[model samples]
Target: MRNVGAFACGLLFGLGLIVSGMANPAKVLAFLDLAGHWDPSLAFVMAGAVAVAGIGFRLARTRSASILGAPMQLPTARRIDPRLIAGALVFGAGWGLAGFCPGPALVSAASGQPRAWLFVAAMLAGMALFAALERLAAVRAQRSQSSS
Candidate 1:
């Protein structure tokens, strides 16, 4: 039941992205072209999304469990640290360059977009690299602890 609900939500989200032109790299790039022929259509879409998410988060914060009977796992981090800044910079750079963030990239990739496929592949490689580096760090930390 949970899997079905998740699939349904994901499908709806993908459809929304497609309908909003977010799945199209050209449209996204046009939106990002602030100095050039800027398209402000996506700003409305983003504003609407932010508004909805804000309300949802507010409501979620009052709840101990999700509507699905699962624990409500929300982000607890509030401080903007160096890691957060670096991550935001990397994310912004990728989005600006490729014109496809993770969600939209996944939608476009599923629709067989070549550039989206490349983006998703690179995204997966980055995730893998990060995981490997984290593992190496953990191993070094463990070794140091054991040696001491």
Candidate 2:
């Protein structure tokens, strides 16, 4: 049941990407190109997405928990630390270089864009780096506990 629901949701998301012209790397690249031939259609699409998600999140906040699940796992950390800054910098640079972010990269993976591969590669590298950092932090925490 869960697998079926997940598959359906993924299918809908992919269809949305296709419908929004987000699955085309050239379209994305053109939108990001501010010099010669800048296409602004993608900006509208992104604004629509932000509007929808913003309203949805606001609605969700009014509820204690989802009907089918527990309370949303919202991040509560408010500190602006070095890790956050570094991660944001990396993400921004990768987006500028690839033009297609993670959502579009996954959608266009079926289209065989070389730049899409680079986007996915960098995305996975970021995730792997996060995992390694988390492991190191755990080790350091354990060492401190033992020393104390």
Candidate 3:
């Protein structure tokens, strides 16, 4: 049942991307190019998404727990941290350069775009790098404890 819901959600999200012209990198890049041949169409898509999520979250907050009876996991990191700031900067840079984030890149890759493949490769590399750094930090902490 959980898998089924996840599948349905993914399908709906992909379909929404296709319908919204977000699956096209050109459209996305145009939206991002504020100083050039700027297009504001994607702004509407983002606005609609934010409005939906805001209202949905508000409704959900009125309930004690989720439908699965599990508490919602919300981020509590309000203070700006170097790691958080660096990660956000990296994400924004990737989005600006590729004009395709994870979702759009995945969708475009379905159509066999070589550029999408490149973006996906770089994105995966970034993810792997982050994971490796986390493991390295853990190992360093262990070594420090042993020495002390």
What would you estimate as the lDDT of candidate 1?
0.95
Each candidate's TM vs. the true structure?
A: 0.95, 0.82, 0.89
Error at 92, model 1, angstroms: 0.8
> Mind giving the per-residue lDDT tens digits that candidate 1 earns over 1-148?
8888899999999999999999988999999999999999999999998999999999999999988888999999899999899999999999999999999999999999999999999999999999999999999999999999
lDDT of 3 by residue, 73-141 (tens): 655568999988998898888888888989988988887989999999999998999899999999999
Which residues of candidate 1, in runs, are more than 4 Å off? none
Which candidate, 1 or 3, has the higher TM-score? Answer: 1
Ranking 1 against 2 by lDDT, winner: 1
Candidate 1 worst ten-residue window by lDDT? 1-10
Error of 2 at 70 (Å): 5.0
Residue 3 in model 3: lDDT: 73
- Candidate 1: deviation at residue 46, Å? 0.7
Query: Which window of ten consecutive residues has the lowest lDDT sum in model 2?
Result: 66-75
For candidate 2, lDDT tens digit of each residue in 1-148? 6577668878988899989988887787788889969999999999998999899878887787764566676567899999899878877776667767788898787678777787788788879988998999999999999999
**Cα lDDT for residue 145, candidate 1:** 100
Count residue pairs with overlapping backbones in model 3: 0
Each model's Cα RMSD: 1.0, 2.3, 1.8
